[model samples]
Target: MIDWNSIAKKFKEADAILIGASNGLSITEGLHLFADNAAFERLFGDFKRKYGLGCILQGMMAGWPSEEEKWAFWTRLIHHYCGQYQPTPVMNDLKAIVGEKDYFVVTSNGEGHFELCGFDPTKIYEIEGNWFTMQCARPCHDTLYSSLEVAEKLSAAEQGGHVPTELVPRCPKCGGPMDIHMGAGQRMIPDTAAQARFQNFLKTYHGKKLVVLELGIGWHNQLIKAPMMRLVASEPNATYVTINLGEIYIADNIKEKSFGLDGRLDELLPALREACEA
Candidate 1:
């Protein structure tokens, strides 16, 4: 594990710090992204019996062959993760730290925690897109519409261990498919505004004395993490600080300038916040 005391000191001295959050942190705070719960198990019991699928989350992602089915699964996921879930103290602490500094966020977490915690949308780069909105599955245009009402309906219908077919979402215009902009594949459309903000952030801050604070970013999706880490490494005075449970390692190029803390963000962020404050 990296010495957080030293890491905190480095963070305090940095000009800009880009904090990143991932699904692991969300999971640590009692939100299951890909895991199954009792409710989901019951709802998917029939599907499970038919396909030998144990977890609803995994089964839905794996079993769905079409965009329409994928959207249905994501619609359900977004409804629960955004509306019903509570933000962790760690997330709150991290938000506080960023608020105190010249900071930006580049996160893969679809829960929209940073924004919910009052981070400026311009300063926050949501690479995985938000859970509160849906886009055309085909993504003919980079348009996103609010999914809050739909999410609420889906959540309500998901009671009594059943997912009502009527609650299943479809494209409003085309009557086709609508999915969360989660970057599942090439078809995944990033919100154009968010994409512009991310590019602006990169262009403005690249190769600077920045601190890249990554929390619970795993290897499952290297699309965002790898490039961001590389950007930090390219800078002469940039440092990469990663706090993750079990796995905590960085490239050798940034190793001397990096701190790898092998632990949960729920435990680490508050400590780091105190240390930074001190």
Candidate 2:
């Protein structure tokens, strides 16, 4: 039902493009968000017995109002998603197209898929923070430190049906708890280096015919989406392209310049690629 030919035609005319990824895009690539693996289900049968929840993902999302519980859930999620995952072909293709031009990626996805797919780190602005890194839970610094090694250890321990005491992540210098670099609450720490790069990217390039290509982004977190949409709307030649599974809506003012497609990225991207080349 989505028109890939029209979308590709628009992209071909744009000078720059921005792509944002969300949970739905990740789900399309065989990543189970809430479903427990056989090992986890076996080890933590009590989790299912007590919560009657399908898996840890659902339970965490369901019980995330409390800060402490939310941090625990995010820690586990960040550990698995960033360290153990690889980008899908759709992600790679999007990166390739954007790479051909003067482009930037601003994604709410914490999975670091943009970087994994070869998007220049300097051009990708992660508004949701990254899962591959950890910062002081208190956010003593603006820096984000890598957690890949610790995440691997935790994932291995979880897969082995045991929690390794030494694998528990903690601040290296302070001996305090370490958490994912997220924009939640008062402790949110944005990566200073990434932020600087984002600013530089914006400053160095402005007034160009830009295209903001949003993929699977939802209204649940407006902090990132709203601001990015505003940025795109402010530019005269800017166009906003939103590709979602079911939710497809655009602002009335920019409706003429926007393309809202209700479809999966896996199918749509390939068609767009072929069309663009043609």
- Sequence-dependent TM-score of model 1: 0.82
TM-score per model over all chains: 0.82, 0.79
lDDT of 2 by residue, 108-146 (tens): 666776787677888877776766777877655555778
Task: Judge candidate 2 at residue 175 and give its lDDT.
Answer: 72
Error of 2 at 4 (Å): 4.3
Q: Which stretches of candidate 1 lie over 4 Å from their true place?
A: 36-53, 59-76, 157-169, 219-221
Candidate 2: Cα lDDT at 45: 62
Best by lDDT: 1
| Ten-residue region with minimum lDDT total, candidate 2 | 63-72
- Tens-digit lDDT string for candidate 1 (1-278): 54667877887887788777777777776666565667656445555565566664465346465443444455556666666657668778887666576787777776776677677877877776767677777866667877767777766556433446665666777776676655335677766776687777667777667888888888555865788678877888788888888987687787888888887787888888888888
Q: lDDT score, residue 160, model 2?
A: 24
Off by over 4 Å in 2: 1-6, 32-80, 157-162, 183-185, 219-221
